[model samples]
Target: MDPNAQPDRLSDLPDVLLVLIMSFLSFKERAQTNFLSKRWESLYLETRDLSFKESDFLTASVYANPIRWLKARADFVGYVRRLVDRIRDQPIETFGISISYPKPYLELIESLMAFAVQKRVKSLVLDFSNLVWRTYNDVNIEKLVVKIPQSVYDLTSLESLEVCACKDFDPSKLSKLGKLRSVSFGWMELTDLPPLLETSRLESLTMKECLVHDLEKISSVHLREVAIYNCDFYFMCIFNLPRVDIFKYRGDIMSFGFDQMNTIISEVELDFGAAEKKNDVSYDSYGIEAGMICEFLNNLLDEGRRTATTLTVCPFLLKVIPRSEHPHFLRPMKTKHLVLKTKLHPKEFNGIRLLLLTCPYLETLTIDLLPPSPIATASSYAGIDPQTYWMQNMSYWCLWEALTTVIVKNFVGGATELNIVKCMLRSVGERLERVELHMPFDLDESRKTFALAKSEMLQRSSMNVKVVVHNS
Candidate 1:
């Protein structure tokens, strides 16, 4: 084998490896590879998965001269058609297309989908958002959807489908595909999706900046995880979940219809803010506006049956949850690993404690304390606790059992911080164990916060907790 010597044949690499490489490439690149040699002429067609992107075509179609674009359009269309014909009748496991309709690319996309459907391609992903995000105010998939071949439903292997940012898409045929497993959507109204998507086998679903109207009915037969963000959802709806592990949603006054879940899902993620709506959903008409943010939290505290193991509260999302008064458990997590990260002085510490009080099985806590954005004198702070800034609540609560391990990050030695630690230690009583405090502070503040913690903590013993000091 010599570096200067050419290989005897390109086919020596094996067809399986070529198909794998082709799957990672876009349609245009795959087309270009066909010109490399006779052996590669059909290599692109052999690939069971394909992703044709309109942006790639348009980006390359541009030239310094407009005259060249007009002259080249016909040749480009002819070349693409030939490529599609090459793959016709081939066994396709997945056939997907993404279009950024900057100008007018729908015709090309429609022809492509027709070819894929004729071959009974299984999975499909139509992403029309790249153009919408750049030019339009919103994304809906209606104007771009076409009359797809009904035979698409006949593909039993069809499992995952993602339709994002189209004009308006009617998901009517999803129910016919019994083998479908996962569905992802964005910037589309919630149609009768349950009727369309045979979601009985759905494992994971994700929606972003979308809308859910009447939540319909979701039974936890095989659902594993659900994530919805920046969505307008139905209010006062009872969700019966059985065997769901993760449920994530964001909107104001989100009611947990968790009374009917058959088995507990492992993780639950949410945003503590009202979902702004341009359309009516059951959740919005119930007066769960931004002002009544705590009402959303109150509902979670009362409705959630399964406690979460991993809890993440977005501080920005939480600020919208009216902290003028302490809120108890916007649904607490029995998740052993609790991660608290905040930029606003965590005014929700007590609220978190109240929420977790119901979690009978929590083990570890990790706290990340972010410094306040700017200085606020005593007057600007007003009603906030002057010493610990632990909201205005004068209440006694233990965040979790004393046996729980506590890790505090960004621990600065300040009078306020020291008081907060002292107060927390007092609550632990005889249960406190190892506390890892990453305290970086001035000599006096560091010593005082440490001393207060030592004196106030009557938990297991002073030796159980140790403070790691870093000079600021």
Candidate 2:
């Protein structure tokens, strides 16, 4: 030992403090601390959060060779069993295990889940999807799935649960989970979700790529956030919820009962994939599908119904809304903030104008210009002119008094962007306070175009407005 050696201040910390810091690190990262000093070799064993993934033990070369893959699987199984045995008596707050292949390790996984229940774990995550199998399309979906064991229902202390790539999961035993507050499921088939909602005091729920059949209605007094993405649904409805704050849905158009959401939601997102032209229904024809969509949007702000403070929508809704002169076709929106994710095409200009007139109290607006998808080129009404469309007789109370800020994302200095900006400036230039343009990459031409437009805008309108540009 050298007399002039610097003192090991970091390693000299107390064991309680060191264990508190190690609790935030992953299992693999905490293992590296064993090499720091002899004292740290056994300090990480006291951590209360244990998360393990099988991929952490295998290399790329081992995945490419069949013989090496078999040996690596055996080694991973042994490692997990030995590690869990060492910490069997330690109380854990979280227990997460991700296995790529679980067919041959059913008993082992059952023992691990039983261990979690005995340790009074608060959060659990069970993931069984294979990475290589999914990326290379080597195995069927059913071959990689596993069913939840009965021992999972004994986790009365669980507050959060996440299960992925599971099938035929009988949710009848979920009544025992009275302490659950949040739940998420993916790539699964479920029926009658009311049992879980009715039994537990759930606050947040999310589901994706699932097949739900014969669901009557979703009603939870304690729920605050709900998201359902790309799922096949049968007989699903949104019933009485008084405490919900945010709602998000993304999928094909379907009949959803929308007259019962009786709360003031903070935000709502409706993203229908690419905009596709329905051959059966024209823009003037109020067909069954088109009528259903219009009715749903109308109910968002109707009397004794739900209303959102912020609304986000895709281009499909703009293209499918019926262009009727009847007042009942579209209702006045109560949203204060509106976000539109679109390609800024000419055909959508009329819809944008209609929305501006409807939202009487809107204060801020955002237009996120998305890249054109492959199917967007097949739009039927692509020949409309923006200049003629925007130059019409209109009465917008928001533009005169309420609206102040406007933001444009992914700006590329296109003709459509210039025309829209000019139209906005003409309508509310005196009252507008700030305008922001966010560009994708560095482009000097875009900055120059904005500079010229800013100069002309100030010359024509009031000098109270501020224009700014940002590059990403």
Separately for all candidates shown, the number of backbone clashes (residues 3 or more apart, or on different chains) is: 31, 0
On lDDT, the candidate that comes out on top is 2
Provide the lDDT at 360 for model 1. Answer: 39
Instruction: Estimate, for each residue in 347-374, the C-alpha lDDT of model 2 and write its tens digit.
Output: 5666676667777777888888888521
Candidate 1 regions with alpha-carbon error over 4 angstroms: 1-46, 53-91, 130-137, 140-149, 165-168, 197-200, 210-216, 233-236, 273-304, 320-333, 344-360, 364-380, 383-472
Candidate 2 accuracy as TM-score: 0.75
Model 2 ranges with Cα > 4 A deviation = 1-91, 130-145, 236-238, 274-289, 303-305, 322-328, 372-381, 385-400, 412-415, 438-463, 468-472
RMSD of each: 9.2, 5.9
* Per-residue C-alpha lDDT of model 1 across residues 144-254, encoded as one tens digit per residue: 454344555455557887877654455656666777778787766666666553444677777766666666555446667777766666545565556667778764445
lDDT of 1 at 268: 55
Against the unseen true structure, what C-alpha lDDT does each candidate score? 0.57, 0.71
Output the number of the TM-score-best candidate.
2
TM-scores for all predictions: 0.62, 0.75
